[model samples]
Target: MSSDLFDDVFTLEDRFYTEGYNQGVQDGARAGRIEGRSFGMEKGFEKFLESGRIASKSLVWANRLPKNPQPGGASDEKCSEACTLPPLPKNPRLEKNIKLAYALVEPDTLSTENSDEAVQDFDDRVKRAQGKVKIIEKMLS
Candidate 1:
């Protein structure tokens, strides 16, 4: 009777152990995916920042030209003046929207406590940027 009691007491249940291990694995995978997605978004935001700077510069240069550029009708001197400025590959509104998006991505003035609001603001800025991109596309075509 003592041997039987000892055997039963010392026996381990593999099922519970396996369940715990599997749960841990699932939890780890979920954590890893969340971290990976956040990292990827940060890297992408950095790239967008660089592009935004370039587009902003281009828009500033284009602003040197007359609001209405008559390419064929403008005089030689006027054309020369316009030619000195950088060509506008995209709409100025698009560049402005991109700048706004860049600012929203990581604003230095925003506090950690307002992170949720900042995220909502960022989403709105991104939507505006997307709309501006569509407008630029239409203008180009």
Candidate 2:
């Protein structure tokens, strides 16, 4: 082939390669955003469920214990009504859970840029925090 023709072909190939790469990058970013959104939604559901479980689980066991009785009604514990309830943050597990849950809910933390690996990092942290929360809950229970 002629030199001019060869040069033209190389230029076109380079342009096509560049365009493909740019498109791929754009697609990856978009995909990451969509995936991250779905993931965050799932995490929100999980947080709600876990929070409910943490708030209610201890109460389950606590209630099962025998209650004091008066002549007519169950005897009230001497402690204040609020004090007798489960502790806030549910427990130590819930402390970590609240931390992670708040982090997940924050908008900035859910970034999905293609080159940033935000999705992977967010997912990893969430999984790790969840595992830790479960372990803590088991210990508490």
Candidate 3:
């Protein structure tokens, strides 16, 4: 081939290679961002569900316990104190679960995107919490 033709071919090849490389980089970066965002949102939503579970579980156990009786007249105070129900025993396992739940739903937590899977997961968690509440009620009863 002539020198000019050879030079022209080389230049065209270099231009096509550069364009392809640049396009690939852009495409790869865009895909990476999307994947990262989706993964983060899923994790965040899981934490949110955990927080809900903690709240519901705590509520189930807390208000069920009887409160201490108030003291009346001086003469009756002693009797009232004795009649008051003893404090309910704390469940260490429940406390640990509550603490974990609180940590999961912090203000700085990331939010899940609006997707079918996320919605379904959220609904499932809510149903689980409700079932727990019902079981607790039966136990207390």
Candidate 4:
């Protein structure tokens, strides 16, 4: 009878332990998912913000490019007065770099999905755009 009692006690302890372990596992899984999602969202926002900044800079550079005055056409005196900034010099290399940078971060071309392939492509394009921007800055300076 004593041995049977001891066995029942041991069995009860084992059952409680198993239940506790299972509960812990479930809770851990839930917490992990929440944390992962939060991290992903933060990183995605940062990447998009950086890309947007680069794209805007490229657009401003493109707009500042000198306009070719057509023969017998009226000069854009109003534009010159409104835009206090001088036009960028006409350089093929500079123009190419500006266009490439803009294309790299174009919203329509970039994917917003969180898939691995999409993330990798986004990162690659942003990196390449950053390099191009640096080169363009050096050239301008």
Candidate 5:
């Protein structure tokens, strides 16, 4: 009888332990998923923001590029001298860099999915855009 009683106690303890472990595993998995999603969202927002900044800068550079005067018509000045920045000197290298940077971060071409391949492609494009922006800045300065 004593041995049977002891077996019952041990069985109860083992059952409790198993239940606790399973519950812990479930909770941990849930928490992990939540944390992963939050982290992914934050990183995505940061990356997109950086891309936007690069794109905006590229647009400004493009607009500042000197316009080719038409052969027969007078050049139409769009901005008043007080508001306008002096046009950027016409340089093939500068023009190319600005276009490349803009293309790298073009919104329509970029993916919004959370897949590994998409994330990697986005990162690669942003890194290349950043490098191009730095080179353009140095050239302009």
Candidate 6:
């Protein structure tokens, strides 16, 4: 009877150890994937800079790559934004050009540079924020 009890305990221990090993394997796999993705993104960004679609001097601006360059992104808002992997190459002639190009990647920061149609549509929003366009939004009947 004691021998049978010992065998059962041993089997339970083995099962526990197997579960722990499997969990470790899963965690390791997930970590490896995250690391691999980060490495790949860095390499791809570097390769893109080298492709000459962007001028050598443009590297100065490109180097200022935002970590989270998505539309309407605040600082470090990468997860909230979706930056295209391959950005367009353009020859902008001014500092504003650099800023605008950066906006092309991350547009949320460029609230002022929203499309002309969008700007026209939001005139009322600005008035509302400034407390200028307050109609009787509701009537307490």
The number of the candidate with the highest lDDT is: 4
List residue ranges in candidate 6 displaced over 4 A: 53-141
RMSD per model, one decimal: 7.4, 9.8, 10.5, 1.9, 1.9, 20.9
User: Residue-wise lDDT of candidate 1 within 1-141, one digit each (tens)?
Assistant: 888887745655666688899999999999999999899688657655744554464355445433454588765575556566654564566555444544443345323333668556544655565565555546545
Tell me how candidate 6 scores on lDDT. Answer: 0.46
Residue clash pairs of candidate 6: 72-108
> Could you estimate the TM-score for every candidate?
0.44, 0.44, 0.46, 0.87, 0.87, 0.33
Candidate 5 lDDT over residue span 19-87, tens digit each = 999999999999999999999889889999999999999999998887777688876555535446677
Residue pairs in clash, model 4 = none
Q: Name the lDDT value of residue 140 in candidate 1.
A: 44
lDDT of 3: 0.58
lDDT for every model? 0.57, 0.58, 0.58, 0.93, 0.90, 0.46
| Candidate 4: clashing residue pairs, number | 0
Give candidate 4 misplaced runs (Cα > 4 Å).
11-16
Off by over 4 Å in 1: 3-11, 14-114
Off by over 4 Å in 2: 1-5, 69-141
Compose the digit string of candidate 2's lDDT tens values, residues 34-100. Answer: 9998997897677546544443543443443334457777555654463554534335444555455
The local distance difference test score of model 1 is 0.57
